[model samples]
Target: MPQPRSHDIRRGRYSEAGRSYLLTTVTHQRRSLFHDFHHARLVIQQLRRCELERSCRSLAWVVMPDHVHWLIELKALPLGEVMRRFKARSSLALHRAGVPSQRVWQAGYHDRALRREEDVLHVARYIVANPVRAGLVRSVREYSHWDAVWL
Candidate 1:
């Protein structure tokens, strides 16, 4: 089988401290059912554990049916450590829930660092609005599986 093409972001480059990122990850095979509101709640809980353990700051996040977008500020740990723990814990939770699969996430995730001049809050709003734009909800507030510190 052919290998998947890599995205533009450099992996493991942000292994140092003090980098903020907008990260995204999708379910394997684009399986929406794996990320329903209930499952997403569990995943969010796991993410919280990761944030607390790694001491990262979560600015915004939204969990869609098959994917998630997170805006976070790295504090004490490297960005890679945060993502690894988040993905690992969420996968374990899904497996415990009887997902009946070998994998829950794609091989890698996408991340982009925010420039100092950019509006971080605006970026967060865009992340939270994904459900509305996808027609899953009439308004972002109506979505049950998203949250942001600014909201």
Candidate 2:
């Protein structure tokens, strides 16, 4: 099979400070089973650890069966470093749980920095509402793998 096009995998950069960002990452090979609700809960726990250790502030998050969406306030660390530590820790946890050795996150993640005029709370609501929007649940409360500080 032909390799996917580079454009299909390219991610943009965010260089501004004090900007809230919405980020998303998918499991390797689009494997939905790799991150079930229980695993998603664990991922959230790990993220909380990263928050305490790296000083990140998570506004909202939703962990889908195959991917995750997070809205976070970049604190003391650079966004790149924050995401690196997050992925590394989560990958290690998943590996120890017997996830495939070849399974790993993609090289880059998707991030959209909010403009100064944008409403951070609105974006956070959107992040938490992903499961409903995707038709995975009738309501955000029905989803077992989502959380937010404001909610």
Candidate 3:
């Protein structure tokens, strides 16, 4: 289970902190907005900001053309609040950066909680190799919008 679906989170389920989650959020209307380097950088900035805020610690991440996949460890907040902050702040930052004054990410994100016995390295590999899976690059090194703490 990936921390329940978006609807479940809204209904007050699986809001636990101090867990690892693989999160995915898409652009509004599935727009390829992040194909633009500036917009992508804005999202990266928000990710770092989230880490600095201590809501979550990013373990690995990949900013795709129309979506993002982030592996993180919740530190000081529930997943819902963390996601809310990320969405809100990123939208505001992007708007300030002249991307748009409207919503940037979709209403909800998908999150998968990792198990204690799970191999995190495998998950990190999956997250960082998304570009290759999407045919955006032939190798992980060619993708600039991805990072893995373990790598």
**TM-scores for every predicted model:** 0.90, 0.86, 0.90
- Give the winner by lDDT: 3
Among residues 3 or more apart in sequence or in different chains, the pairs in candidate 1 whose N, CA or C atoms overlap within 3 Å are: none
Q: On residues 48-77, what C-alpha lDDT tens digit does candidate 1 reach at each position?
A: 886777668888998888888998888787
lDDT of each: 0.81, 0.77, 0.86
Model 2 clashing residue pairs (backbone): none
Single out the weakest 10-residue window by summed lDDT for candidate 2. 6-15
Candidate 2's residue-wise lDDT over 1-151, tens digit each?
A: 9965634544455445566888888777777853465567667877788679855788888878888888888888877778778888888887777776775676667888888899888888888888888898888888778778875
Comparison by lDDT, 1 against 3, better one: 3
Error of 1 at 134 (Å): 0.3
Question: After superposing candidate 1, which stretches have Cα over 4 Å from the reference?
Answer: 5-12
Better TM-score candidate (1, 2): 1
How would you order the candidates by TM-score, starting with the best?
3, 1, 2
